[model samples]
Target: MSTMTVRMNEQDAELVRKFAQFEGVTISDFARTAILEKIEDSYDLQELREAIAQDSGERFSIDEVLTELD
Candidate 1:
């Protein structure tokens, strides 16, 4: 186990506390989950970039990716 210190603006801290209460978790757990989610998102983006770098020059255009949204 490890411990760390975090400082937050009073208003932001209060909002986190309220949200944590609503979610039935401690404020610390809520913050940890939020931080972990951001880390996972960045990690996924990095992996996607690596996969693109390994591609054999074929690429999808923005239009191709967005066409399904229409």
Candidate 2:
């Protein structure tokens, strides 16, 4: 495991502490989970953007999907 140091203004620190306390987690745990979720969201957005940019004009409707499944 590794350690990293983060500095924040007192107000922001207090907000994080309060939220952590409310969620029954240590400040570090809360921050770690928040950071991981944000990273995952960014990756998902990038993948979506790439897919959209690669669009080949193929189109589908709900009925078409259901008929194919049937």
Candidate 3:
């Protein structure tokens, strides 16, 4: 196990502490779990940014999205 230090604003640090307490975990454990969970859910950033850059705001509704899907 490795120990690392990170800096955050007081408000953000307090928020983390509150959430950790609510979840019955140490701040470190809560942060580590949150980080790992997000990484697991994420897609490659390069592909996401490329898709976003090409988006033209042309498809703005559920119907349009369904049309494209079908």
Candidate 4:
């Protein structure tokens, strides 16, 4: 694995350290998880926007589906 360095103000760094300790994880692990989660959230939001844009605005209800099936 490659090592990465992050630069932050001392106050922010202390906050990260404290949060990591509170969560029982190392600072690196905490940062890695936080970064990956942020990326995943952004990807999901983009997908949702694309899906909404492509949507046809069709309406459906479970009862209608069941009636149609019958």
Overall lDDT per candidate, in order of appearance: 0.91, 0.95, 0.88, 0.98
Q: What tens digits encode model 4's per-residue C-alpha lDDT throughout 1-70?
A: 9899999999999999999999999999999999999999999999999999999999889999999999
Per-residue lDDT of candidate 1, residues 1-70 (tens digit): 7887788899988898899999999977988999999999999999999998998997788999899678
Task: TM-score winner between 1 and 2, please give it.
Answer: 2
The residue ranges of model 3 lying beyond 4 angstroms of the native Cα positions read 43-70
Ranking by TM-score: 2, 4, 1, 3
Q: Rank the candidate models, highest lDDT first.
A: 4, 2, 1, 3
What clash count goes with each model? 0, 0, 0, 0
Q: Best candidate, TM-score-wise?
A: 2
* Model 2 local distance difference test score: 0.95
TM-scores, all candidates, are 0.70, 0.88, 0.58, 0.86
Tell me how candidate 1 scores on lDDT.
0.91
Give the 10-residue window scoring lowest on summed lDDT in candidate 4.
Answer: 59-68
Candidate 3 per-residue lDDT over residues 12-58, each given as its tens digit: 99999999999999999998998888786675666788899999977
lDDT of 2 by residue, 1-70 (tens): 8887889999999999999999999988998999999999999999999999999999999999999999
Highest-lDDT candidate: 4
